[model samples]
Target: MRTLRDDNILKLPDGRQLGYGEYGDPNGKPFILFHGNPNSRLLWGVIPGSPFLPGTRLIAPDRPGFGLTDFKEGVTTLENWHNDVIALADSLGIKKFAVFGPSGGGPFALACAWKIPERLTSVGVFASVGPFLPETVVNASPTVRTLWKYAPRLPGLFRVQMRFFAWLARYFPNLYVRMILTEFSETDRKDYARLKVADFLRPDRSEGFRQRGICTWYDAMIPATWPIPLKEIKIKVFLWQGKEDISVPFAMGRYIAEQIPDFEATFINGFGHFWIFEHKHMGEMLEVLVPPSSSPRSK
Candidate 1:
């Protein structure tokens, strides 16, 4: 199938390479996008006419282990993820650009802010993460217990474990939804068909994702805590979230805004994890986060 948008390959400064797409003028102001895990270059493809597109040049790269990029079979960590992205920007001859990280793509953008704060116009997150997944859902939910029901080729013993949990959750459907809703509080409650399946998935879907042109994104499930060194970041910061989301919780968006000093800026409400389109105050959002073309620094 011909892609709905133009795509290209980017060779980084260090000899490593990756696939990417540049929307709008290549010479225009750079606005690089970072996609979440278990997805290819598709996540960044969603926003074409977003309020930010008219004036900003958009660049999105496939992460090392995700999209078409590769590294043997070693574990993929957030730090490695960050370096690979920086390499992508460097490859493009982009000294600095406004950075956008959505969902699992958050850490990479933050890492750039930390490592090269000067090369940033701003750092933004939409339905991104910072804290560990909650434990109550882990210890109590039957939905996660039966997380393997959709796995067909698993060994016999694993099937038993899955079936047992399925029996518990399936028979008591309420408990399953409750557990999953609690567990996925950041994304479970949002509108669909907007962000596409790229924003949400079941565990078994991991294998299917590879078939659709993405490596497994299970690495995101590994828990960790991190701070983005906000005090050192001099660029403007923006955050937005969808209230009904159940995957990364709107609270994190607020947390990010408040934690970062320098006039924490605006946090728009009612936009779900997938709701980056048609924002009522888009021009204002852009004015603040996208940097002013007339701003002295931009000059």
Candidate 2:
């Protein structure tokens, strides 16, 4: 497994401090990773070694207001998010890199493909957010489906809802974990049992609400906004979705694959939302993102 590095904060030209962390070989090929909603860079535990690719550096950045970064609140749009990413890359002296977004981060990855395709070597979106058409929203879990249907029109309600969960996560972490685990598929529950998932959830849950309540609320409201121009994306794209995923749902991934002009979609049979981050699943994604020079790893 790659050695975990401490968090590093970059002072952007705009004076915003962006928190990020690096994993794997520092000198290896760069791949910028965007975490899911209400999640920070800390969620990506560690990357195990793989044979198909030589080496890679995974860069995980906490979106504005999620971790140590300051929340931009009303100032954050898809364009603004893309600009922040570019600034971070420039500061790192990295001109080109791959972009990966697991869930809520998916839209941001697509935004990069749309706004700065020249700078990206490839784009990978796993269980990505899709267009908020009525049919798509219907496939989501009950709680998420309700939020997706009404959150845009009632942003205050969304804030209240997240704040409640935040309070639960802070004051009663064990209970909060139990509540959340109920939403996961059986496969994910087994994975959670074997790992310290609660530890990863605690910090983001507390800080995300305390520091950037509006940012969290607004990010959830993204699907209600204008549709991303996925068809315009020219960079190579990889889309992965699990058939049993309820948080984002399989339909969401299918929709994204249909919209992207250049994409390879992989649908796993029994996995759910959290399984994509597991070592086995992540290895598969890395193979696609960083194919071998002689012959690419087959899906």
Candidate 3:
């Protein structure tokens, strides 16, 4: 089992570095895990026991500006991410793979599905926001809604907020975890303590802040005017959301699901965003992405 300290770097054609963490069976069915905002590839550490499902090779990558990945300068939209994902897959000699996005990573996952559906075997998103319109922003958690309210109009103030978040994640890791936990529902909070999620999240959160909060801010802000045409996505998309999720409103998930041409969803009553990564829950997600008949046991 490799820890988050292990670094894997791949230099892309654009002269930027893409940093990723490879977990589970190296030769197993390839599955890319797109992490959320303010989290690095090390977010994989949050899964108790192994991060990947049986017979699934989990490739968790830091999107530009998070963790070891180089931050892109100026205005870059979510559409640009499929190129990186394709490049990474080609480098790994993977012809086809599944993609799972959690939280903010949802847009990137959808982007891949839209732009490179031929290369994708499966796609899914858990507790993620979609097409961050004014109505969508209204569905966000109070904290996130407040940030969305100000992030565009008050760019300087947003940067200051991001800097403060960086400081909190770096200097007060425990508190940082707790602060995030505060938004979780009571159901999720209990699982947080039982699973010791903060233990795994502390380092991941700290690494996410290594580049400070500007990248995270940009990442969070991109969906406001999503470039991907969800109606044109040719691949099937699976969605999971918790009605009790306060971090990302359940309606956001519903919005995306409705737009997707081929979509299936499972909305749980009591679950929350953070709790979806619980080992068993993640396993179930993988089961849907890659059914038992097609999946072989991990060597």
Candidate 4:
């Protein structure tokens, strides 16, 4: 429940500030948490309570302009975000830590691998977007347009396509939430609704960025276009994908897992997009990020 709002402002070289939250032991090694598109870090408590709280130090930050973070006037590219993450960790005096990227948080986590693998002990990616081909977008559901607004620059009629998506978010907010909610499994839906979904599930919660629909549109271009490719990364990776994932098709997850240089990929049949949040094995997941402390000998 503690947040960066109470902590000192973490300023990046470019002068942007990151909104972050810390849970569990402050002295413990850090594990920064990242959430997905249209979401703030509020998605973590969906597990009823974070498994990270007992011993692990979990730092959850809202993307600039998303949650409690100030959306400053600057380009919110992968590099900038990554640097901000680094700056945040530096501000906290953490030299090494693991990263947990879930859904939208996946891209930022991968960026951490790309930029600061030397400082990482482990990295876990959950159903994140990979290098998607533009052809996929051309053939994607109409929802793809909503995801295209944030790309570097879209010549020709791309802006017009973005207009349509903005229209949907503005006029059909309820329907948009339902469309997104449909991707979550039944239990995750209940868990999310009851837990931490409110800050991220509505336009009002993301009011500053609501009209700046470019972030979603920009997220679309990422799978098709990565400024820095994952193939160039040097980190060993672990991932969880659900075969039935609809939001981010499990097929995409499988594709990335196979292609990443050193990866351990796992797929759970019948599991869907939100399965990472729906997991009964999160304790194991946390163990990967924060290993248990050694115990004393018993009598």
Q: Estimate TM-scores for all models.
A: 0.65, 0.88, 0.91, 0.76
- Compute the lDDT for candidate 4: 0.63
- Cα deviation at 206, candidate 3, in Å, is 1.1
> Candidate 3 residues 140-164, lDDT tens each?
6677766655576777878887888
- Candidate 2 wrongly placed segments (more than 4 Å): 1-4, 46-54, 194-196, 199-212, 292-299
RMSD in Å for all candidates: 7.9, 3.8, 2.6, 5.4
Q: Pick the candidate with the highest TM-score.
A: 3
Clashes of 2: 0
Q: What order do you get sorting by lDDT, best first?
A: 3, 2, 4, 1
lDDT of 2: 0.75
- Between which residue pairs do clashes occur in model 3? none
Tens-place lDDT per residue, model 1, 4-80, is 24457766555555777666545566777776644456554444334453555667676665545554334345545
CA lDDT scores, all candidates in order: 0.52, 0.75, 0.79, 0.63
Task: Report the error of model 1 at residue 51, Å.
Answer: 4.8
Name the candidate, 1 or 3, with the larger TM-score value: 3
Give the top-scoring candidate (lDDT): 3
Which window of ten consecutive residues has the lowest lDDT sum in model 4? 136-145
Candidate order by decreasing TM-score: 3, 2, 4, 1
* Candidate 4 lDDT by residue in tens digits, 40-110: 55555434334444556677777665555655444787776777877777787777788888776788888
